[model samples]
Target: MQRLDATDNAKALVRQLAETHGDLMFYQAGGCCEGTQPQCFEKGGFFPRTNDVCIGTVEGYEFWVDKDLFEYWKHAHFTLDVTDGFGAGGFSLETPLGKTFQVHYRVFAEEELEKLPPVKRNIP
Candidate 1:
């Protein structure tokens, strides 16, 4: 099963972004002004460290999370969502469009945990 997903609105936004930006990627920020928010960028805009985890894909774009943050959130499933405003850091591509990416999470069920897909830690 996939660990990450996106809302209809978010998918649409990604499509819009890809049309203009070519390709995209997402990284779940750990802290600082970004405040654990999901930031979207041109595929190579923000590099994923070796220890960062690629939980899954959303709209065909890799969705990665910080290693320590991933450890803290290991039991949860994430859904990427979009909202109609600016995020704190304003570093995400959507921020310029007056939108921001957000993540909604739910703890995995016992059965789900058993079948959950393995996360990729090696950055490609």
Candidate 2:
């Protein structure tokens, strides 16, 4: 499994979100401008693909991604740094292909989190 460096700010934000929402799912998806981007989903969203890597937990919350996707991006050698705040948003990962993937994390109200569907792998 690949390793991820969660900034102190990112950790704090994740902790706050998990405590308030129950859980968080981090996703890696194909992007229009770049190869891929990092997205954080509240509890009740889709899960990771079987080929993804599980990077352990952040702030007591579990996190993982599709193994094939992870490997593709891993070969690109990306780094992530998050910035937390009401309007400051999260961080971005710089992929080995010289593309940048952005991450946005927001506080999801209980009702909002409840409305989201469970996370699952997108097999294509």
Question: What is the per-residue lDDT of model 1 for residues 5-80, given as tens digits with 9 covering 90 to 100?
Answer: 8899999999999999988999996888788899999998999988899999877889989998999999999999
Off by over 4 Å in 1: none
Candidate 2 C-alpha lDDT tens digits along 1-124:
2244466666665665566667676666554542355656675576665556654456655556556665454433233435322221133221222333344333445555455444334454
Residue 123 local lDDT, model 2: 52
Give lDDT per model, in order.
Answer: 0.90, 0.49
Candidate 2 achieves a global lDDT of 0.49
Cα deviation of 71, candidate 2, in Å: 1.9
Q: Give the TM-score of candidate 2.
A: 0.52
* TM-score (all chains, Cα) for each model: 0.96, 0.52
Off by over 4 Å in 2: 33-35, 75-80, 84-124
